[model samples]
Target: MTIGKRLFNYALIYKKTIIFALLMLMVAVAADLAGPFIAKRMIDQHILGIDSYPWYETDEGENAVLYQDTWYKREDHFSVDDVKGKEVRVLQVGRDYVFVDQPVTTPEGERTYEDGTLTITRSNEEMSYPAVELTNDELLSFYMPEVDDLFKLILVYFALLVVASIFTYGQKFFLETSANRIIKKMRNDVFTHIQKLPIKYFDSLPAGKIVSRITNDTETIKELFVTVLATFVTSIIYITGIYIALFLLDVKLALICLVLVPILVVWIKFYRKYASKYNHIIRSRLSDINAMINESIQGMTIIQAFRRKSETKEEFEEINKDYFDNQNKLLRLNSLTSHNLVGVLRNIAFVALIWYFGGQSLTANSAISLGVLYAFVDYLNRLFQPITGLVNQLANLEQALVSSERVFELLDKDGTEVCEDKMPRYKGNVTFDKVSFGYKEGETVLHDISFEAKEGDTIALVGHTGSGKSSVMNLLSRFYDTKEGKILIDGQDINTIPVQMLRQHMAIVLQDPFLFTGTIASNVSLNDPMITREQVEKALQDVGADRLLKNLQNGYDEKVIEKGSTLSTGQRQLISFARALAFDPAVLILDEATANVDTETEKIIQDGLEVLKKGRTTFIIAHRLSTIKNANQILVLDRGRIVEQGNHDDLMQMRGKYYQMYQLQQGKQSSLAG
Candidate 1:
């Protein structure tokens, strides 16, 4: 789906809240709109006293009159039954007729006059007289109650202002809350989806770039919901409402203001086109900068050791400069199209209004009244304020769209292969049937490979670097699918098993074991509720890791710093071995697990491995041949194919590649000893 449509879906989930917010916004807009109307009424009727408009006063009979496309109440004369204390508004006055606020009511079957004049006769009709015209001063005499009610008018106006403020605040609060909720969900969904992506996806992307998508991009989207969205909605309403008021006041002036609509549309269309493009570049560059920074921080020690700190710094400076340059481009665009440009448009509108009205007065010897002119200017200013606001929000809107596009791009990619819902547990019998694979397409690294490990057998893989030992391990775990042939667990296709279920029953102790920042017990059990404390203690004890734990201040509860940096290589390996034992996986893969430890530490790990491998099929990928000398079977791989396979003694008798590698390693050991 398009980013726009996807964003709409998020909004739809909170439709009720959004609807309520919009309604509140409208209520606030209505209250705000009332301000100019009230000002106009005070100026025209109270201050200028423009005309005398007649109104009816009667209590008993129904009265109705039609004037100027409106209907009002009219009576021939005042009656004793007339309501005693109600003040009537005089809406308009002319030589022939008058308009009023009172509603006109006619008897059901009476023949009524269409014009202002009306006559009625009855058995007990009261005294009556013809409708009379009143002067502005005479009308003011009837408007004495308004003068007395001035304080009440001011209070009501202020009350409406308060209502507007309250509703506006409510609208803001709800919109911000909704935005936060959406951003929270987006962050969670992105992070969860990241876990489900294929392993190869991570190989192609940096951790920081991925993190940027989850954190920075979603943060940018927040403005869409909170500020940009609110501004767009409220500004549209304000613009439309202002135009409506303008039309009601004077169609000619209103029509003149209509020119701005097309201009604004064109401006936005042109601006967004370039803005989105620049913003996309800006976001991508930012991701690059984040990736560089993350890599620099993580590998600071390596860079310093290699004496390449200056080169790394230079490379980072280049990336940072690229980001800064792109940002300046965006800044320039914003400078051109936003507030400053909007100010020019606003001033142009004011100049146009003045020019048009001034021309009318000069050419026709007539002009709109000062009060009407003032109200027009007020409404016009209100109309432009929102337009200016929209212009100012353009940059944020563009940034949001760019960020959303990147976020959705990640979400749209294909996830890992699907597996059966109910996968059976393997019984430690693994088989590879002429399997061929690669980390990427068209680059096969493992070809026509076949292997088998019966239950409880320890199979060893010995090979030079890039000879497909780790690749086989990865395929056995189904981290990558076979490009050709098949891998099976207990005679069932490994691909049929869910990755989670397969990995749950398989444990890997890597060459460099990783530990999270938590207690050793927590790391061993990974905080899994299924692994009891007793099981963790026993697992550590069985792996000879209890000695390392006892040395710490808190046995089994000692805090491990990031990546177990505070622990010795052997200690970390022992903890990892303990972790694998705690889970008691049906299959174990040790990838050079003791490669970095001392001979004494290796001996300790070797003893631990004897226990770890009990009743489980094990695959050992080792650089040190002596470590796997007693394996039940050894497979020596070369150029993506196993060239030698047999028991250690059987391979030694053959005097093949494995025999040569073992002799080479012995020479190195003898030389080091000398």
Candidate 2:
């Protein structure tokens, strides 16, 4: 099902609660109906009595049919008193404005209304008409029925009110819970899809923007479950109830009031269509701003180092301004268009309804009763009010659709492929036989490269800058697959081995090792959560960091600042070595591990490697030739091709690229010393 339908269907899930809430609404409306019914009773049976002949007729406006009312002037007033509010007629008899003052007393011998104001105050005697007087007869016969009925209705009103409160709270609780649950599931799916996406996708994607979509975008969608669902569902219920009540009370005037509804509905549909797009634009700009903020903050060090604060600030200001403009446009358009339509609808409906009821005096078979018509007029506006509100929520509804589509897009991404070998362990014997690979089209970094390293062998890779040394290492670890040719470990093609198993057998210590924010012990034991204190201490001792930790106030438990900024570069290198040693893999790859360490520390680390690589395969890439002199073999690469290979003494004898580099290094050292 579509997301909008799915969100709407959520209401059906809590059918019992919704039904109960509706029942409460019925009670509340019933209580509300009491006031009008009482007013009607007072007018019909009590005030007018059986002898009074009241009138009923029809009234129309500019569109009225002429033949219908052409014979008589359209009389629209129902006067209960004279111009002076007196219950008597003028005499001369009425041609000249003369007051009639008769000294006749009422049946109880009281006198009234002989002045200009015609004020009627009760005199010392009792009233004869129970219609005008309030007494025991009136109480039992008329007032009792109305009051008792209203009393019962008020009771039902409060009772249903409690029930409504229960369901209202239930609606809030379930909506929030369900919304949060769906968001959690969606967030996990988004993260999982991102991880599965290929490297090129990440390169092309804006890092901060993706993060905002997963976080802020998903949050915005979550609101739809409760906000739009509750609002629209309740509004529809109110609209339906109102229309039904009006029809049940007075169908003719009900029809008149309802004519305006279709017009409003079509207008709401149109306004909402445009409002949806503006809402999407506003939300998209918000996500864009979030992306920019994250990227700028993360790259602050680079921006500062390059003195790019002004450029970054301008970029940020531009995005923020766009976001503000879109937000204001969305909110303004939504409010003005919706409310203006509502005002026009309300004024026209009320005008039509009031005209119809006011001309109810001349109809033949008058089904019109004054009180019932009053009730209809009272409730007419409320019927469409909810629909107008529901119309306003269309913007939020559309935004949710966009977010859902974005989320599903991520779920469609393909994950990284796994290799064939499912073996949990391996004997380290790596070979690159005519392997060639590149990142992009028509550009190869490693060209027809070939090499071999048996179990327990350390093969050192030496090359000029940009000679594809790191590229070859990355290929061996399967960070990037070979475009052509093959790499083998033991007799099988490297691609035939599962990545997880291959990684378990190998460890890589990069030139600039990343140290996360955590205690020294936590960072080293990240891969193996089960690593004990003894293993951590041994690893630290092996890399000669334990002595340094012992001097610190908190020892291994001390917190490291982000990227280990509190420590020197050499200190972080020592920690990286310890972390790598803690893994105890079957194969080790050291890429410039000791390039930044002091001579004394470098010597200590070399001794540690000698003990650690007892029966494991190792790949060493170093700029300093002295560090890798004792490797089982050395491979000198020139322009992505292996130019020389042998033990240290054998390669020196060949006097090729490897020998020439060695001689150049020796001459530079001698020149520095002299």
Top-scoring candidate (TM-score): 1
TM-scores for all candidates? Answer: 0.85, 0.75
Cα lDDT tens digits, model 1, 446-547, are: 989998999999999999999999999999887789999999888888787778878878999999999999999999999999999999999999999977
Off by over 4 Å in 2: 1-141, 240-292, 355-366, 369-381, 417-422, 496-498, 596-601, 660-674
Candidate 2 colliding pairs: 56-360, 56-361, 56-362, 57-359, 57-360, 57-361, 57-362, 57-363, 91-94, 421-496
Candidate 2, residues 1-674, lDDT tens digits: the string is 56666544654665665556555545444444444445555555433321122112323322111222321111112334312111321111111122222221332121233334323224343422212222334223322323444566556656655665665566566555665666677788688677656665777668876887798778877767657766776677666667777777777877776776678668767766776676667667776787778788778899999999999899878878887887787677777866777777788888877687656544323536556766676676566677677767767777777776666666666666444454655678888888999888899888898888899899899989988888888888877789999999887897876666677778888887778998888778874766787888788888778655677788888888888878766667767777777877767888988877777767777776676667789888978898888999998887787888899999998888888888888899889889
**How far in Å is the alpha carbon of 160 misplaced in model 1?**
1.4
lDDT of 2: 0.67
